[model samples]
Target chain A: MDRSNAMPTVLHAPISPADIAPFKIGDVVYISGVLYTARDKAHDRMLADPHLPFSLQDACIYHSGPLIVKEGDTYRVVSAGPTTSARMNAQTPSIVKQGVTAIIGKGGMSQEVARSFAGRCMYLAFTGGCGMLAREKIVEVLDVYYAELGATEAVWKLKVLNFGPLLVAIDSRGDSIYETVRARSHERLLRLIAERKRAL
Target chain B: MPSHREAFILHVAQALQEAETRLPRDVTRALANAAKVESNDRAKEQICTILENVKLAGAAGLPMCQDTGVPIFFVEIGREANIDFGLKEALATAVQRATDAVPLRKHAVYPLTRRSCDEPLFDMICDVSEGNRLSVAVLVKGAGSENVSALAMLEPLQDVRPFVLNTIWESGGKPCPPIIVGLGIGSTFDGCARLAKRTLLRSLEEDQSPFEAEILEQINELGIGPMGLGGDTTALRVFVEEAPCHTAMLPVAVAVQCWADRKARFSIKL
Candidate 1:
């Protein structure tokens, strides 16, 4: 809950562990630099392949399935928004183990995934459905990998500029905003249900 | 000039683009109000970004969100229109054209094989109306909210409140709250699910009944807030559409819609 700094932290990708160390849950961040898009299928493929075409060292993984179209010679990103991240929960820790230091997505991730960030990772929450905003930040579509996975599921290498207003929802210490919200909300739900039972 | 059937197909494509790019007026107003009331900095920021995204999408004529979603069409055909064309086939063609024209994400895939489908992704529900006007509306539904939607066949005495609350709780930020909840009560299993999904098309500008308001209040009370980071605006509205069912059955379905609330409509007088 330390949102003391009014300014958003500017992060450059290939984000290092040290770069993410100062930020905590509830802080805001903006990313500028290289990131890769990896959804459910891409995650499976990335982990299964022994030799990935791209390196994962200090890489920033974006849980997105961008709407990209080919324009004769090159690809154009139409609308690139974060997909639900919880679905990637299982594959995430393994990806983190491969030296991923930053993950940008919506809907947050699992507690297990939070625990996976214990020492060298952070999860940034982008507003869901903000595809146009995301598109604005993406300066270039560097390349595409795994085109066979379909445009939505393929791994896209992108270069972005100040790509955020992302909330630091999970810190390296394993504290998570989603976990805290869920706990508080559960208590309220129980109270409301109890009142309902009594009324009945 | 294109044939009447061709014209109708083009209309559907235009409707798809309208639905994908612009947040409906009712939805935009609701989100604006929600933004004003949001006390938490995180929640406020999320709402503001959504508003900004909507503006940008509309201005640039881009799909508001990347997940343009499976296009669900609600077609109201006038009986006197004497429809000569294959409505379903025409709708399919429109979707295919829009896939490239509006640049919708090719979201449909084969269920088992998980490969891309040649046909554009869409669902259609048709209704017969009195006049000679064919009205078509589209709701672009994203997976995040649609996945969390639940249907429960509760006992006759079972209350609907708990099921609704529990669904929202389990959903957490996954559906991208502040969500719009559509509740279908007292119909057959599949019918109730349809009832719930259809309710999502209703404009938020419409008034809510006390029951709908109460459920809405209770849901927001869960404090799941925007993106479930926690706050007062878990859901902007709750719409309930109920149908009488057998005495032994109390089927309820919850259809969750994300904040985008993207929808558009077009009417043709034949």
Candidate 2:
């Protein structure tokens, strides 16, 4: 509950595993520099393909499918926001093994995926559905990969500038805020059910 | 007179674009109010970012969310309208045009195979009414919130409250927090889901009944908070829509809407 310095700590991509390693569940941080986008299809491809289109060593992968329109051979991002990460739970552990230091998305991942972050990576919870906010942080779309998957699932390599007010939902130590919150909520739910039973 | 067919198509596309880029007033007001009262620092921060996102989208004239959701249209057609356009075909074409006009995300997929396509996607519920005008309201339902929606057939005399609460609780942060709950009670299973889905299009400014108020209070007490990060505003509101059911059945459907509950409406005089 330390509210000191409400502003998030600024981070740049291509960060060392140890750089994001210090962040705990609930630490507020911002990211700038290079990141790559990958959604469900991209996840499947990244795991099955022998060669990845781009390197992921100590890279940051954002769970996003941005809305981009081409302008004279360049892609101008109209809206770029994180998609739900839970859908990628099955593939995330393997993706992290590719040397991804941090993962950014909304609606935090499952326990199985969090376990994969044990001393290797962290998960950043971007504000869900905030394409406008995310777009401001993203300065440019440098390149895109896997266009065959359609626009929403393509992996867009992006150059960002101070790109986040990312909430650390999962720490490198394997703690997930989603789990903690669900547990607390479940306890209250039981109490609620008991109250209903008594009333009946 | 202009081409009613072309005009109608433009009308639907405009509604889709409006739904994409703008936050309807009621939804925006609720988010602002939720942000002001949220107690947890983390939850407050989430609200701040959401509020900032709203402003950013307005300034940029782009979609407030990249998901852009599946465009769902509620079409009310006038019975007396002198119309030659095939209503269904016109709507489908409008949706496809808007998919690019609004630059909506290419998200249509083959449900069975999960194969993605550039198809113009939309679902419509049509009703014939007594006027010479067609009214369409589009709701942009992003998948994050759409995936958590639920329907249940409770035993007769059983309470629907617990079912609704449980659905929201189980969803946790998956649907995004500070969500809107639309409850469709007492209909057939699929019918209940439709009832619940339609209620989400209603304005939050409308007066809430006692039951609606009660459910809203109980849900916020779950302490799921904003973004499920922990705080006062797990759900901004709960809307209940009910219909007559058979004596043996008590059906309930929960349609969840995220904080980015984007919707818009347009009426054309044909």
Which candidate number would show the highest TM-score if scored against the true structure? 1
Candidate 1 C-alpha lDDT tens digits along B1-270: 335799899999999988999889999999999989888877888898999999999999999899989889999999998677899999999999988897989878999999988787789998998999999989889999999999999999998899999999999999989899999998799999989989999989799999999999999999999998899999999999999999999999999999988888999988
Superposed on all Cα atoms, the candidates' RMSDs to the truth, in angstroms, are 1.4, 1.6
Per-prediction DockQ: 0.92, 0.80
What is candidate 1's lDDT per residue for A87-108, written digit by digit as tens? 9999999999999999999998
DockQ of 2: 0.80
Task: Name the top lDDT candidate.
Answer: 1
lDDT of 2 by residue, A1-200 (tens): 56575665888888898798778887888888999999889999888889887898999999998988887998878889888888999999999999999999998888999899879899999988889888888888888888878777888999999888888899998998988988998999889988988999
Return the TM-score for candidate 1, rounded to 2 decimals: 0.98
Looking at candidate 2, what is the lDDT of residue A73?
90
Stretches > 4 Å off in candidate 1: A1-7, B1-3
